[model samples]
Target chain A: MSVDIKKYLEEKQQLVDGYLEANLPPIGTPPTVLHESIRYSLLAGGKRIRPILTVAAAESIGPPPKALLPVACAFEFIHTYSLIHDDLPAMDNDDFRRGKPTNHKVYGDGMAILAGDGLQTMAFEWCSRVDLVNDIEPYVQVQIIAELAHGSGNQGMVGGQVLDIQAENTKVDFAEIQNIHAHKTGKLIRAAVRAGALLSGANLTQFDQLTAYAEDIGLAFQIADDVLNVTGTREELGKDANTDAERGKQTYPSFYGLKGAKKLAQECADRAISRLSSFDEKADPLRGIAQYIVSRRN
Target chain B: MSVDIKKYLEEKQQLVDGYLEANLPPIGTPPTVLHESIRYSLLAGGKRIRPILTVAAAESIGPPPKALLPVACAFEFIHTYSLIHDDLPAMDNDDFRRGKPTNHKVYGDGMAILAGDGLQTMAFEWCSRVDLVNDIEPYVQVQIIAELAHGSGNQGMVGGQVLDIQAENTKVDFAEIQNIHAHKTGKLIRAAVRAGALLSGANLTQFDQLTAYAEDIGLAFQIADDVLNVTGTREELGKDANTDAERGKQTYPSFYGLKGAKKLAQECADRAISRLSSFDEKADPLRGIAQYIVSRRN
Candidate 1:
């Protein structure tokens, strides 16, 4: 039987949310607002898709190790920080995310910026904390950190963001947009998959397959997001709809019609699932996640 | 004989500058402006004090290892990124830094912010690159990453910045200002020393002594800065002078007056040197650095 992806995602989301809340500095912590603002955005409840990918990827290789939890949470922290910064006045200028006022709107731009800065540093902090992940090899931990930083740094997410900003309101070709998405969103997603697999001691063959699987889903996820931005409502998506067109951003939908974009997304999902054919039932969540990426409403 | 700190600092700075120039993404790399903005702020002339401290501290314990350079450079990267973000319009709103237009002024606010973000991630990336620091044990590398992140994260620099922002144009007591400086500037400086010491395998006593030395010098460095802000010329200082008073920020001079602040700084420096009495002539650079803290004109 196919895995019940909804239940799987929910369970994983709860696991991530609980860990983040427990580990985060409490509300009464010094610099209360910075901590509060960080918690506000982080705990504001996105789909936790990135972290769950980390968890699901690890589970595919072995039983989800206890140490996998923090790394998963680290990805969530990085993703949340990126969203907080992207929502700032200097970036996308969005006022809301996930149906709530963005961090800058509530905390003011300065604190929001600090909140993002704090979260980014904390991601590395969590990864390097030996006490939390003592069972994992120090060497593996270094490799995980390298993966996270490389994926998130200039060559990756931030580079993509720069490209996105440059592309705004300008005539951009298909190749340019693909390059942007691959660097911007795909790198971190791939890193999340690799980190999880690395923590679980995936062999070379397993690792390569997972990397291929991650790339397919990463593209599918972005294309699906582009499609949803056009088709979904603000209330349904918990964010501004049709923002890509408004911002003059080039997307799959911009190049192809809605039907064509959806078709591409489905093909990516299919390829992602097919990459897992060698694995047993343990790989089902990975399979389900690929399907879910194209089908999710938000 | 005492170490000639001027020549020593010059040599270390050259080494750091060369390494950074070589390892950083070349100018023609994709996302060119982002890379340019990062290099603009980083390559701009500054004292290179933090990384020098890392190198000096490592030398105090043993010959500075090849692996120590990246960690040393990591501290500089962290320092540069903080300055860039601090100069943002939403934050300090500074028009200039180090006698040059701030990153936001030259590159626009969004790219400046992204550049800073890119630099911050690069710091961690450098720390974890096994290829560059293979001589260092993975466990020690994790420890260094932990130290850097802890000293730079919420409980450290970012938290300190929040405190500094909150104290701006407000009445704050000596204890409050001390707390702010300890968190804001002191923590990272201490981290620099500790990371250097760890890289060179300092014994517990050596580590503790270095920690004590770092604390005293950290306070001294801030107090000296406070004095210079009040007494130094804009040209000499290479940035806005008297900004603390203009902003009504509480500082050592605000509490102690110029004369008293200088006295306090000297006393702290003396104590810092005293902490290094147990070490041989190898630590002369550390002692000289303490003296330089209070004596430098800007």
Candidate 2:
């Protein structure tokens, strides 16, 4: 019953990468600096997890349209843009990200900010203008845009980031951790999964189950990140180890001890997989992803 | 031949302000600090030129739907978000905007960045989800979104800002000045007019003439801003004046002396009004606005 999660993930990752590189504005576009800056970070490298979830979730229900690839890449752009801005001097202020110089270090701060701004706006362009296929309902397209915006907006990732910054050195309870994680990373992840389901025309029951599955895995993913922050090496994580502690950011490891956090991660993965019993082998990739999120070394 | 430009601008400004206050996330939202920061800058007050242009442009074509109000406010959010980011310590580092403390000055740098980010995302949220009317073509809505995204994105406003920041302390030529102004402020203004015309289903000729009209006035508006920076008092400008030269930002006044710059503005205004000759009284407000942009002291 075990799925070849590694192979499944790799194939999806390549699909998303292909779509992104092919569809992104060419580097020679009039303002070469901006286009270069955007491609510099966007094409740099990452796990491409968010986009893979989109492509996979859509596949889980049925074969998705070609438009799904651009749609998936749009989420990746949002994630990448958030990372670029987060690493700015005014925020997390990190010099490095994913084993490379941060955007600001390479492009200068103003250009870095604009690159992030450009990428964010481009994401919306890709999301709403899926003119390649007319199958997606108009309101559904609007809903997808609204969902992405909500996940990225004040009450979601942005608010979570504000709270995360302000909560440095402040004691946070379990609820606070849940709230931050749910909003910061979880909402976008959930939206990614739900967006795919909706695009594939999932029924209400299937949508509900997938939503639950996404919530469980989203939490598990963040917990693994928190656990890795304490236990993983810098080379393995592609970022500083214990940097979370150094910055006084509250984490699952900080709230629950090492053993407790690990147990929670496993439990979340288990719960996530359990939510897919309604589907047959079609959901194997999503289930495998839930497990991999916790099992990954990084 | 003249309209009550002052009263027209005032009424439109009030419409946008009312929409913003009534629609923005309440201050009591869980992350009240972030919400307060957004409202603080959004409602703090300015001319609301961009949004008024949107509403006015729509009205010029036909009786706009209710969704026009939200769409109009979305531009205001975009404008306000840019201002908030522009005032950040890493950028212009201004302490005050519109005679009050800037976002970062009151909320700290992290909050200000998040507030800007939040508002930017919210702008997208508002741009989408216009479920109120079916008169707008689905593609038209997406086109509106794309236009807004293009205007605000890297190749547009954000790109202009990057150039403006980098050009500080550097000698700039006339072409460079036009490039910056055309992209920075002009594109969005053009989009406002274009968005309205498209929403109201303007013919190709109307669209073309209105686009030219928008371009002329948009450049004129920036030239007016340059002139004001050189001559207006701090009390009238609501922000620092003559600071453009101090920051080494090249301006129209800097390139073409004050008198020459004023003459250029008049030419732009004249060309803008000439484009509206095709329309009857329906376009009087736009005609008046074109005149007002240069005539305005602040």
Candidate 3:
């Protein structure tokens, strides 16, 4: 079953890859250091899951996946900016991310920081300028801005990050940990899904279902991350593994044991799929994505 | 003449100061490190020129200065965030800003970076929630976001910063330097003034005249900054003076002599005041602000 999930993800990843490469800020003549830093992290290899989910969600409601490329790229821009900033000397302070020296490590922190800021502003600029083909309403554009703003603002990702930083070296309860993960990671992921649905003019019923699916998978995704951090080897993960434990950071595997963490992830995967039952075959890609979240090794 | 300008600015500064202090994010109970970094930089003393201009511009058109407090506050948030980021290790690499240790110096690079990111998001969040009394139109809110996005985006301040970085130690011509300053610093100043006027529903005639005044003063403001960088004492300036020459950064005083720069600034002030001639006595505050820009010691 997991092998099938991998194959499906590969296909979706290819589609997302084409869209991302096409949408990136072009490497123009006399490209500045800031532009290079932005491109470096954006083009760095990843599963491209957030963008894929965006397109998949849009498809689940209405419209071809290609039409949503600008928004999908915007999601990638925000995700890449977060990763670049997170890897900076002041934050997670990681020297490497995704098997490469992080943006700050390669480009220096000043350009890296500006690159992140530029990408973030560019994300909204891209969304605002997207040609909606007369299908999406102007209010939908406003909605996208509002959703992205909330997902990225103090009450969402930034707040979650504050809690995460404060949680360092301290034991936080499961509820607190879950809340941190929900806002820190879950909000953007959920926003990606909803952005896609909203672009396609999703009705309230469909939005509610998609929201449930996104919330379940987002949590499951983080649980699997915790599981991988403890259980996977560096060679398999292509980056540091078990470093969280070494740093004394809280994780499900630390508090509940590896087996318990795996069980929780499986339950989340089940719940994620159940939320998609109301949709027709259009949601199969999302269902496949949820299963991939819990079962992947890397 | 200068005495009256100083007195008027002092009064405007007092009002802006009280409003900003009131708006500062409360020291969170058990304040997170990042929150502290944000508050520290936000409260550090400056002239409060940007917010005051916002209020004064609005008042010059139709309403009392108090009506634009929320928009004024939003402008301050954006200004403060830019200053924090500009002082970071990757950008200006300054040790002090406004007579205080720079945010990155005080809070470490990571927290300072997040603080800047948090403040930028907070600006928009503040705008979204502002109590629009005096029947400010909803479309005006949309226009504010659009104008702000343009001013802060690649075509505006960020673009100017990038150009400034590239021009460092290079023998750039006067026109290129002026373009950079106009975009980098002038755009936001102009936006601040225009935003105020737009909020008050100023007509096209008022818009044209106000924008011309803003453009003149924006450049005048930068010329004054260059003059201060070269001529002002460090203790009086709060931040380091002559740091531009020390860093091999381009400045009006560096290209044109200090005397020439001062002359240019005075001309800019003259032009700015002349643009407001069509207005009645109500525009006196704006004319005084232009004079203050040229004569300010810090």
Q: Indicate which candidate wins on DockQ.
A: 1
lDDT of 2 by residue, B1-298 (tens): 5579899999988878887888887669868899999989988878988888877777778787666877777788888999998998778889878988888989898788888888889888888875743656666677777778878887788888877876789887889989999999998898888888877778899889899999999999999999999999888888888899888888998889999999999999999999988887878899999999999977
Model 2 pairs in collision: none
Between candidates 2 and 3, the DockQ winner: 2
Tell me model 1's lDDT, rounded to 2 decimals.
0.92
Candidate 2 chain A: 10-residue stretch with minimal lDDT: A130-139
Task: Give the least accurate 10-residue stretch of model 2 chain B, judged by summed lDDT.
Answer: B130-139
On the 0 to 100 scale, the lDDT of residue B263 in model 1 is: 95
Model 1 quality (TM-score): 0.99
Q: What local lDDT score does residue B46 receive in model 1, on the 0 to 100 scale?
A: 75
For candidate 1, list the clashing residue pairs, or say none: none
Worst 10 residues of 1 chain B by lDDT: B130-139
Model 2 off-target regions past 4 Å? A133-135, B133-135
Q: Evaluated with TM-score, which candidate comes out highest?
A: 1
lDDT of 2 at B36: 92
**Per-residue lDDT for A1-298 in model 3, tens only?**
2235567668777877786667665666123566777778887788888888888898887675344777777778878888888888778888777888888888877778777877777666666553553545545665666677677767677777877887899978988889889988898899899988988888999999999999999899999999999888877786788889888989888878999999999999899999988888778788888988898888
Q: What local lDDT does model 1 show for residue A118? A: 94
Tens digits of lDDT, candidate 2, A1-298 = 5579999888888878887777777758757788888888888778898888887788889987666877788888889999999999888898878888899999888777778878888888888774743867766677677778887888778888877876788887879889988989998999889888878888899999999999999999999999999999988977778999888878888878989999999999999999999898888899999989999997
